[model samples]
Target: MRVLVVEDHAFFLLGLVTALTGHGHEVVTAGEPYQAEKLLGERRPDVAVVDIKLPPTHSDEGLRLAALLRSHEVPVLVLSQYAVPEYAISLLGADPRGRGYLLKERVAGVAQFMGALDRVAAGGTVIDTELAAMVTRAAARRAVLSPLSERELEILALVTEGLTDRGIAERLVISVHTVVTHVQSVFRKLDLPKTPADNRRVLAALAYLRNG
Candidate 1:
């Protein structure tokens, strides 16, 4: 895959470039949002890995870049040390497919990080499970939507992580029937239709991300 990496940290940026190259990807590096924008105009990459903060402003520059990339139909994977649910929410305002939010510390393993990149490149959202949980909890506390019970919230988080009903049941130590019931309740509360399981999960996740 051809990738554009937008990050301000010099050493980490070089390390990421090396890692992606080692994994048989062509990489272009940018230290700031403007540089990344210039590169985007010149060459289209399969995916863009962007930091949520950048030089000059150190604010939402990366968020704006991600929005621009999405407008051009480019996939984006945002990386950050902080969960910053707000930032994730902004990046996901576009199409859910080809979007990801990964915590930097969790990406120390090359294989796992590359796997996230591959998932985004293939048009799948790959949010960190921990971050997703935090976001969901915050949303529940806010009551922006109907509040979910603890068990229901847990099932929703697992659903966002792409786990199967049986997997969620096993992880939560609940029966498959119970998991199915929780899932149905979650969909109803979130106002997500009883469509395909995957679509329901995506819509539920979008609600959690938006309201959280």
Candidate 2:
């Protein structure tokens, strides 16, 4: 796989490039958004790993670039030191396919980062679980979130982590029936629309994260 990395921090960039190369991926490096844009025009990569902040403006240049590239069917995985909910919402927009938002700390694990890159590159969403919890907590005051019990909130967080019903049950040491009940409650309380063709669990989580 070919990947374009856009990050201004030298140390992080070096480590990321090394890790990706070691994992058998071809890497193209750029230090800033402009250079990244130039590279994008010149060569199309399988995926773009971008930092949420960049040089010159250092304020959402990576996100702007991600949004721009997505229009052309480019997959992007954005990393940030902090999980800015607004940026996550905007980067994801309506189409969550081929996009991901991860905390910078997650990059420390080469396997984890590579797995996320592979998923996003294949048109899947991979949001950081901690970030999803952060967004959920911030919106705790909202009425839509108020109806959910603490157990329901826990289940919702697991759902956002891309856990299956059985997975959530195993993690929580509960029955699959219990997990199903909580999931149903979460959807009902959150007023998540029913869409059989879509990944409604993820959509519900995104909606809560965005609105909250």
Candidate 3:
């Protein structure tokens, strides 16, 4: 696979490039947004690993670059130091496919970072569980989610982590039936429109995370 890494930090870029090369991936790099856009104009990589805060502004430049990469048909995985849910929401936008937001600490575990990149490359959503929680906690008392009780919010967070009813029940040490009850209430409070897909749980969680 061809991977594009857009990051301003030199040492981290060195380590990441070495890792991707060791894993048999071809790599292209850009230290900042302008250079990244120039590379994008020349060639689109299979996937892009971008930092949220980039040089010059050291703010959302990398994030905006990720969006541009996606516009160019390259999948993007945002690797950042901060767990800002709002950033994740903006990065995800309306379409979650081929988009991912993972905290930079995951890079310490090479396997985790690669796994997330692989998923994004395959056009899947990869929201970090920690970010999932921050997304909800940050939105607490905001619209849609304001009606949820504490337990419902907890269950919603677990849902965003990709846990099933049974999995959530096991982790929370509650009966599956109890977990289902909480989950049902969560969706009801959010008032999600009925859809044929079984991903209503995910939609409900995303709704809450984006609302508050």
TM-scores vs. true structure, each candidate: 0.79, 0.84, 0.76
Quote the positional error of residue 188 for candidate 3 in Å: 4.7
**Model 2, residue 201: displacement in angstroms?**
4.2
Q: What is the per-residue lDDT of model 1 for residues 72-127, given as tens digits with 9 covering 90 to 100? A: 88999898888766666667773567888888875678897897788788777777
Model 2 TM-score relative to the real fold:
0.84
Point out where model 1 deviates above 4 Å: 139-152, 161-185, 195-200, 206-212
lDDT of 2 by residue, 1-212 (tens): 99999999999899999999999999999999889889988989999999999988999998999988897688999999886667777888887778888999898877878887887898877778887787677767565578889999888877775556876798799999998888887887777865432234665687766665
Off by over 4 Å in 3: 137-155, 161-189, 195-204, 210-212
Write out the backbone clash pairs for model 1. none
Report the number of the highest-lDDT candidate.
2
Give me the displacement of residue 106 in model 2, in angstroms: 0.8
lDDT of 3: 0.78
lDDT of each: 0.78, 0.81, 0.78
Global Cα lDDT for candidate 2: 0.81
> Considering summed lDDT, which 10 consecutive residues are worst modelled in model 2?
194-203
